[model samples]
Target: MDFFHGQDSLSILEWTLRAAVTFIFVIFTVKIMGQRAISQLRLLDFVIALMLGNIIAHPLSDQRIGLKGSVVATIVIIVLYLIGVFLSLKWPRLRKAINSTPFPLIKEGEILYKGLKRARLSIDDLLAELRKEKIEDVKKVALALWESDGEISFFLDPQFEAITPSFYQLQTEPFDLPQTIIREGRIDLSVLRKIGKEEEWLTHTLRSLHHTEVNNILLATIDSQNNMKVFLYV
Candidate 1:
């Protein structure tokens, strides 16, 4: 209770309690902020993350700083952040201002010097970004843009693009993601039902074809064609 307000002196247990309470409070605050806060650090998200961290961090280190004030400040900051996000969505200009427009770094293998200067990215940095994408030759790039999230997006020229079956006018079968029917020796009944198969059928098939028991299997998946792929535990 003392930790909630300003504390003059504290024991080890009080400090520990403060840490645990602060940790849970921060987690709860972040949960309300949603996945976007952690997954992407756009301008608005960056500001929210920075403020929340600083506000909550002060109370953990200093006994004079109260958890009560920090918690209230965090709530207020999060509400403002959410409001900012909503307003940005409603207004296009605000969105553009918060998350600036992408800068064109390269176009048809030609470097845009003006854009590089505007984005404050050096030639070496651009080269390093290109190298990270496994693009050694700048001439092969059709377009490259500096994204708002400080990441580079590169597109290879049509002629330099990787060959796919479609390029050869070849017909490819439709893709169906394989569903995991069994994992760690446990049958996923929901998946079995989704695939229109019964546990008895899966058991019999494994015994007849793989000569293995369900308990010995570590993982298994079924494709659209009823093709069962099984991997036994090592």
Candidate 2:
């Protein structure tokens, strides 16, 4: 059975086998590449993505192209990509070259037209980005940087910033993440136990405070204070 190096005319079963093996190979390759490879597409990452797509796609579409050759080429490319990533981490110059340093788009509430040109962003693009950040006035921005990941980081001027608890040195309780006890009209016994509460306790609390059955509640959560909140299905 010709599986990897397909014949001139491939059988449907052979084609299916090739596709399945390719799919599994792609999945494992993606797994090998950590989260950053998926999330952030830097220069190196972009090159790797393009190369892999082109290499894998040709063999799958054309029976004349051997599947085994594509797989071998992909393996070599992946190895080279890993080496580039490792070298980028060790060398600052290479790192900067691969993922360029942040360019200052705005300073002291003034837009840098040269920065915009260098970043290859038009005035309309800048305006659209500002609108997305909900800043009506450019003067309100103290600094705005064009990051390597094609995202802009904005900093509001001190006068335009909101007053926070830290500004007044106010005391605040530690933030507590509420644990889910019930979801989709089903009670989670493990979560209930983790919160140090019994199933009977949950039943009794729901019946007394909310006057609702466990099955009727769509979602429920409890905080550190044992304060249970319930949401019923609409």
Candidate 3:
């Protein structure tokens, strides 16, 4: 009893051994489960991970439970996880039931309130995701799907998408994509250099626009068309 309560050599060694074994087991299990198990975890995979964490923690903290029992428990979890993966692959209905279907957040630039409610997401949340995709207006999106992994995939309307030179049967020189040179009043020197521009050139341009300081600019970018767009602080 005293040995279990105290931080003695035997107790330390036992805890260390338990943690090592548990870590190795978890690593191998994850390796066998493949990248999808950790990257794009579905509901069943998420639940199994949570349960496995608790099961592993029990033996690590409890001095009474031995390593053999912990190993057996972990193996059982792995087997169940494999079975779940098999079922999900073999049966479409079971897969849909386990992972759920992608929710249609936006269609034809219209927000689906019912889908938002079902996904437990608010209008603001969807707006934030849209902003992350560089979309200023939802009207530009033809379709938006809320994936099971909680990621929003956007499909832009053909009218809102950029037209290629080939569409007009015109030959154009190769150009680099637009990169932000300044964001929120901070000058990105690396981006400036990447675009074949210098700090001196940027400063001169700002002077021409009646702007003296880089800190006074809110946003600035140069497009493939060699056009410099600038937004000043209000």
TM-score of each: 0.70, 0.77, 0.54
Error of 1 at 234 (Å): 3.9
Candidate 1, residue 202: the lDDT equals: 93
Query: TM-score: which is higher, 1 or 2?
Result: 2
Q: By descending lDDT, how would the candidates be arranged?
A: 1, 2, 3
Model 3, runs deviating above 4 Å = 1-40, 165-234
lDDT of each: 0.79, 0.79, 0.74
Residue-by-residue lDDT tens digits, candidate 2, 1-234: 477883565655565555456544654565345223443556656666766898889988987777765676677667667877899899999887667688899999899999987777788888899999999999999999988767789999999998989999999899999988999889999997787889899899999999999999888999999998999999
Residue-level lDDT of model 1, residues 122-202, one tens digit each, is 899889889999999999999998777667789999999999999899999999899999899999999989888888999
As a whole number from 0 to 100, the lDDT of residue 147 in candidate 1 is: 77
Which of the numbered candidates is closest to the native, going by highest TM-score? 2
How far in Å is the alpha carbon of 178 misplaced in model 2? 0.8
lDDT of the structure predicted as candidate 2: 0.79
Between candidates 1 and 3, which one is better according to lDDT?
Answer: 1
TM-score: model 2 vs. ground truth: 0.77
Error of 3 at 155 (Å): 0.7
Per-candidate count of clashing residue pairs (backbone under 3 Å): 0, 0, 0
